[model samples]
Structure formats: C-alpha cells, structure tokens
Target chain A: MNVIVCVKQIPDPALPGALDGATNTLKRDGKLILDDSDAYGVEMALQLVDAAGGGEVSIISMAPNGETAGMRTALAMGAAKGILVSDPALQGSDALTTAKVLAAAAQRLGGADLIIAATESSDGYTGTVPEQMAEVLGLPSVTFAKKVKIDGGVLKADRQTEEGYDEVECALPALISVTAGVVEPRYPSFKGIMAAKSKPVEEVTASDLGVTPAGWAGAGQKVMLVAQAEARQAGEIVEDDGESFGKIVAFLENLKVI
Target chain B: MAINSVWVFAQVTNGAATTGTLELLTKARSLSPNVTAVLGGDASGVAAQLGEFGATKVYATGDLAGKLPGVAVAGAMKAIIDGGDKPDLILFPQNYEGRDVLARLSVKLNKSVLTNSIDVAVDGDSVNATTPIFGGNTLVTTTFTGEGPYLVAFRPKSFAAEASGGAPAAIAAASVPDLGATGGAKVTAVHVEESTGPKLDEANIVVSGGRGLGEADKYAMIEELAKLLKGAPGASRAIVDAGWVPYSYQVGQTGKVVKPSVYIAAGISGATQHMVGMKGAKNIIAINKDKEAPIFGIADLGIVGDVHKVLPKLIEALKGR
Candidate 1:
C-alpha cells in the first residue's frame, strides 16, 4: 500500500508569526519546521506502510525559497523520498490554490493508494485542504480520524464528531485527515538523520506541475484589512489568600451559576 | 455583484436542525432577503425550524443513511447551482460536516473559502469576512475577489439563532449525482462518549483543567467541580495532547470554541490558541500558580494560586453549599 502524505512546512508556531504589510499574508521568509500536527500523519503513514508489509511513504510539501528543512524531518521519519513544490509565483496562494498545487504534485508522483494529512495546519489552520485535495483528485475522504485500521483493501477510521465518533470505511486511493495525538511520533535517530540528508528531494515549480499563475493571481480571495481585535478588559486580580475559594464561590453566586 | 440570494449549508443532528445552522440562517436572512437552506440529510423534520429562522426554501437531498455527507451533499448542491440557482454566497458553520461540504463545494465550483469567520458584512457585491488571528489578538477582514457562489464558514456562536415565527419552509428535492468512486466512504458505526453532565460546549459553566494540575489523575478535580456546579468538565490542549483527557474535552482554537456564561480555567496559562476558545465567555475565572500567565490578561478574576489547593477548596465549598 503506497501512501503519500501531504506535509506542511510552516514558520515555527512557538515563535511569534507576523504578516506582510504589503501582501497581508503571513511572512514565510524565515526558516520553517514541519508542522507538529503533520507529524501524526507522517507517523501514521509509516505505520500503515509497515502494516501493509512493503510499500513506500512519500512526502509532498509546498514552501517558499526552496525550503526542505521541514521535508528533511519527515524523510528522517522513514518516508522514502520527498517532493517540494516551491515557486516565487506561489507566494500568496490561498487554500484552494494550495489544494490544486499539492494535488498536481501528487499526480506528478503518479498517485498513491492512500494519502494522509493533518486535519489542519498550525499556522494556516484552514482545516480544509485535505478534503479539497480529495475533491481535486476525485477521491473519497474521511476526516477527523482518531483511529485508522486497514483490512482487505479497505480503510476503517474512527471519525471524530461533536457528540462522539463515527466508524467510517472507505476504499483505497483515498485521503484521510488524522487528528493529532492519535499516534506517538518517533524521534529520528542519528542513523535516520544521516540517511535523510542523502534522501532524494525533488524540487519543482508551479509550471512543472501545470499550476501556473498560482498564488494571488489564481486566488479567489483577498485580505482587505488587518486590525487589532477589541481587547477584553482585564478584571480584578487577587493573590490566593487562602480564602480565594470563597471569592470564586461568591462570583459564581453573583452569576447565579452556583 | 449584489448578493441577490444567500444559501446556508444546513446540518441536522439527532433528527433536528443544529443551532449552528439556524445561526447561519439568521445571519443569511439579514444579509439577503432571499435565503435558501441547502440540507444534506432529510429536511422533513426541520423544514419549519429552518423557516422560523428566515429560510424561505430548503433544497434537500433524501436520507443519506450512513454514507459520508461530503460527496453526496456537495454533489446535490452543485446540481442545484447548475440548474439555474444563482446564489451569490453560501454560508457554512466551522464544524465537521460544514467544513467537509464547503471544501468539496469549493473544488466543485472552482472557488475559494474563508473559514473560521466571526462576522461577515455585505458591501455591494463584496462580502467582507472578519476572522481572528494570533488567537483573537488581531482580526483580518477578507473578501471574495472571485466569481459568485462565495463560500464562507463561520465559527459557531458567531451570531444568535433567533426565530422569526415564519411558516414552514418550502422543501425542494435535490438529487445527488452519480459519484462513482468518490462517494465510496460509509459510516459503519457511531460511538458517543458517555457523559453524565452537560455537554462541554452547551454548559453554562465550564471548568477546564490544564497541565499545572501536575498529573492526569488530578483531572478528576475538574470533573468534580463541574459536576457540583452542574456544568461540564473541559481541558486545555496541553492535557488533551498529553492524553489526560479526550480531544473532545479540549477548549482551544484547534478544539471547540466555547462561550459559556462562566468559564473557570484551572492551571491553564492562556496560550493564544487556548484563549481564542474561551475569551468569549461572559465571566472568566483563571487559577494558576504563575501570576504572569497570559491567561490573567483576559480573565475576569485571576486567582494567583495552585490548582491543587484551589480546586479542592472550590469543590468542597461548592459541595457544602
């Protein structure tokens, strides 16, 4: 079972992220890391490949300035190879355009039996690209997956819902967005890190994938304004003087929630 | 470019229209007098409710049974749109089903979607959507620059769901086109987590525990407090990621956005992502040992204490009452 995981290289979310004043988009000129969310997908893909006995796991990512630092992390985690779709024209692409570019790159890889991705990226947080990719590829998608198991060419997933979870089953050549914490991602060992440095990572452009005029030129949406949100006023602050619980109870009583 | 018509992708759970759908309907009605509800499941039961929220028409597909709603629902809406329906905008809630349908529909229509919106304003052919960034510290207003049938997904509780006391909406049957292999997913079973008190999002009071509680077992204090107050237990993403609680119990930007009457956060040191979820609460009470935790910035009452001592005392005090 060949699996292709769509990974995202994002500005380290731990640090502050700033938007470009000119483009009204998040600045991406800094060093990027593999989104922590996508690690669950990559780990799950590796496990699925292992379970299937013998298949390769490939990583596909779109980043600016030929960024492969994020892809190198995924490759170290046991993915066979990597494909990075980078282009100056792909700077301001929206999610739909992203789906198109990534979808095109996946097709260029001659497709896989299954594709996996995080339910959403930490930086973008659009949470729609996996399904959009599935749509562009005309494949079935099962999202918000908490648990996944493969049996007899069918994929079964415990899909998370508001109330609980739904047991969903889909055919092969499909896409699934796995939720975080579903699996424990392993840290790359020294040997694996050394191997990842030599792993073949093919870099391509929008024209190479036939998604020319990508980014803002192909985007259907534009940011009109960016402003400070109305700040929530800070109320009273009290050091716990041992009777703090009484204060809490009194506050609840005032709200009539007690 | 005037929004001649607006459509809401309605969702139904437990045989009734969801509150999020009604909220969207309420907002859609305000934006355009001509409001249509596009439902994926049977609309027979909720047609009147849809109308009460100002949806004049409900274009629905027959029962989906257990099939995944994305392919069939998007296909049904595509059929309606292709059959001469000219809605300028389609609104969706940022929920599971809504996101699924909106994503597929964006691809089907070759359009883009703006999601996690808190507000939308109609401006003569342009619909500006306001979305929070950096965890509600800043807001960005985006507008559709493309063709019609704009798709936007709003977070739940973005608007109130008020009924207009209108007649039952007229229902129009829409067919799901042959999906071939694209509609191959099926739901084989459903497992609802057993809950003893109010749901986390629906509760009037939410008591969430975080990593400062020290260990997983201490989460019981949160449940105890929530139960004593007749509310629901919640968790910070840290604890949820640490496997102390289910992801469903998480309250954060990536989890459930909750706006309870009173939200008591224990041990959670207000990350921007966590703050985005509960900042809308009418009353915020935070308890953490660190006095400078960012959570204190927006907290209505910040208790500079440890959850270990504070939660127990609070639970005991509430029980005594």
Candidate 2:
C-alpha cells in the first residue's frame, strides 16, 4: 500500500505573523518550519505503511519560496520521498485551488492507495482541503479520524464528531483527515535524520501538475478586506490578596454561574 | 438586494437540534426571509425546535439509519440544486459531519466553501462572511464572486441560539440517494467516554486548562473546578497537542468553538487559535503566572498565578478550605 500525506511549511505560529497590507496576504518571507499539526498525519501515514507489510510513505506539500524545510521533518521520520509544489502563480491560492494542485500532484504520482492529511492546517485552519482533494480525486473521504486501521483491503476508522465517535469503514483508495492526538508522534532519531538528507525530493510547479492559472485563479470567493481584529474588552485584573480564589468565587456567584 | 432563500444543513443529535444548528438557523433568519432546514433522519422530533429558531420549512432526507449521512445528504442536495430548486445560500456548522457534507456539496455543485466564518453580513445581494486569519490577528471579509447556491460554514456558537416565537416549520421528506459500496464509511461501533456533567459546548460555564497544567494528571484539577462551578471541562490546543487530553476537550479555532457565558482559562497563555474558540464568552477569567500573557488583554478577570498553586487553592476554597 502506498500513502500520500499533505503538509504545509508555515512560519512559526508561536510567533505573531504579519500581513502584507498592500496585498492583504500573510507575509511568508520569514523563516518557515514544519507545522506541528501535520506531524500527526505524517506519523499516521508512516505507521499505516509500516503495518501494511512493506510500503512507501510520500509527502505532498505546497510551500512558498520552494521551502522543503517542513517536509524534511516528515522525511526524517521515515517517509520514502517528498514532493514540493511551488509557484508564484500558486501564491494567495485559496483552499480549493490548493487542493486542486495537490490532487494533480497525486495524479502525477500515478495515484496512491490512500491519502492522509491533518484535520486542518495550524495556519490556514480551513479544514476543507482534505475533502476538497477527495472531491478532485473522486474518492471517499473520512475526516476527523481518531483511529484508523486497514485490514483485508478495508480502511476503518473511529471518526470523531461533536456528539461522540462514529465507527466508519471504507474501501482503499480513499482519503482521511486525522485529528491531532490520533497517535503520539515519534521523535526522529539521529540515524533517521541523517538518512533523510539523502532522500530524493521531487519539485514541481502548478502547471507542471497540469494546473492552469486560469482554471483556479479567480477562486469562487474573494477576500474583500482584512482588518485587525477588535480586542475583547478587558474587564478586571486582580492580585492575589491571599483571597483571590474568593474573589473569583464571588464573581462567578455574582454572575450566577455557580 | 435580498437573498431569496437560505438552507441550513441542520444537525440533529438524540432527536433534537444541536445548539450550533439552531444558532446557525437563528442567524440565517436575519440573512434571508425564506429559511429552510435541510436535515437528515426524521425531522419530527427536531422540527419544532428548528422552527422555533426560524426555520420556515424542514427538508429532511428521512432516516440515514446507519450511514454517516453526509455523503447521502450531499448527493440528495445536489439532486435538488441540479433540479433547479436551489437556495440562494447554504449554511453548515463547522463540524466533522458538516464539513464533509458541505465540502462534497461544493464539489457536486462546482462551487467553493467559505469556512470558519466569524460573522456574516449582507452587501447588495451578496453575503460576505468575516473569517479571521493569521490566527485571529486579522479579519477578512469574503463573499462569492459569482452564482447561486453559495456554500459557507460558520463556526459553532458564532451566533447566539434564541427562539423567535415562530410556528413549527412545515416538515417535508427528502430522498436519500443510494450510498455506494463504501456506504458512507459504515459506522460499526460506538464508544462514549464516560464523564460527569453537561457537554462542554452546551455548558454555561467552561473551565479550560493549558500546557501550564504540567502533566495529564493535573487536568484533574480542571475537572474538579468545572464540577464545583457546574461547568464543562475544556483544554487548550497546547495540552491537547501535547497528548495531555483528548481532542474532544480541545476548544479553539481548529477544535470546538465555544462561547459559554463564563469561560475560565486556567494556566492558559491564550494562543490565538485557542482564543478564537472562546473569545465570544460573555466573561473571561484568565489565570496564568505570566502577567504579560496575551490572554490578559481579553480576560474579564486576570489572575496572575501558577496553575499548580492557583487551581488547587481554588478547588480547596470551593471545598471550604
């Protein structure tokens, strides 16, 4: 079984990111690193490949400036190879357009038995790419998966929902988006890190994957304006007068929450 | 400059409309005069509530029985729209099930989806949804460039759920198309993690812990405090990411969006992702040792103290310590 995992190289989200006022886009000129959210997907893909007797785990990422730093992390974790899709035309791409490029990349790879992705990107957080990719690929998609297993050519998962959990099973050649904590991500060993440096990384442009700018350029929706979010009004700050707990209790009581 | 009709993919759980669905329906009322609910399973139990929230008509796909319902819902709705009986705008809750249905619908309809919308407003005949990007640093107002049956998903609790004194909607049966061999990923079994008290999203007061809790074991204090206050226990993305808690406990942009009446942040530094989920809280009380934590900016009450010390004390104080 072969698996493809989608990832993104994002500016460190721990630090604040700036917007290009002129373009109203996130400034991506800063140093980028592997988004932590993608790690679970990578880990899930690796484990799935390992459990399937012998298989390869490949990564598909769309990065600015042709950044492979993030994808390298997954490669270091034992993924066989990586593909980076970068192009200026791809800049400011919306969720569906990005999914188109990814699906096209999957086609270039001659397709895979399955594709996996994070439930949502830590940066974009749109939570639509996986489903969109599934649509483009014309495959079944099980999202928010907490547990995934493959047996007898059947892909089964415990998909998470607001109510609780649902047990879902689908045939191979499907797509899945795993939530964080689906599995504990393993640390890349030093040996694995050294081996990753030699792993071949394939680079391609959007058109190289047969994605024409005109096809996705004018996304169905357009971002009209971006403004600083209004700050939630500050209410009160209190010091521990050896009775701060009491004050909170009183506050909650006053609000009738208790 | 008016939307002819609005459709909400109403979510029903245990024979009632989820608060988030009702909330979306409530907001949908303001956006369009003709509001309809596109629901799954029998709408009989939830029809009254959906109506009370301003649903004029209920379009249900009957009962899905065991299928996940999303695929069939999308297929059914696609048939409806293709039949030229399309709503001007469609709204869905930003949930696992909701995203699945809407995303598939986006493909089936050859449209795109606008998700994580914080708010929506009318501009001429177009409906623009405000979505916070850069982890809530900036808000971008987006609207479709062309065509009808626009798809948009609003975050849970983005709008308040209120009754409009409307009569029960006229419930109509909708056909569920045949789900293929995959069977919408057949649900085989279900396991509900046992816990006491109300659900986190529905709770009036929510107490969430962050990485400051040190370890998974310390989350007990959070459950304790939530119990004392009769609230629900929630966790920041930090702890949930660190494997300290289940994703179900996560409250944030990427997780569950909550807007309880009172939200207490214990040891949470309040990352933008986490803040997006609960910032709508009527009152926010943050407890963290770092006085400079960004959470203080939005906190209705900021308590500068370590969770290790503050939580136990608060729990003990409530226990008459």
Best candidate, TM-score: 1
- Computed on alpha carbons, the lDDT of every model, listed in order, comes to 0.91, 0.84
The lDDT, on a scale of 0 to 1, for candidate 1 is 0.91
Instruction: Give each prediction's DockQ, rounded to 2 decimals.
Output: 0.81, 0.65
TM-scores for the candidates:
0.98, 0.95
Docking quality class, candidate 1:
high
How does candidate 1 fare on TM-score? Answer: 0.98
Model 1, runs deviating above 4 Å: none
lDDT of 2 by residue, B238-303 (tens): 898788888889998887777789999998998888988888889999998888888998998898
lDDT, candidate 2, residue B228? 86
Candidate 1: give the TM-score of chain A.
0.96
- Candidate 2 is scored at a TM of 0.95
In candidate 2, position A152 carries an lDDT of: 93
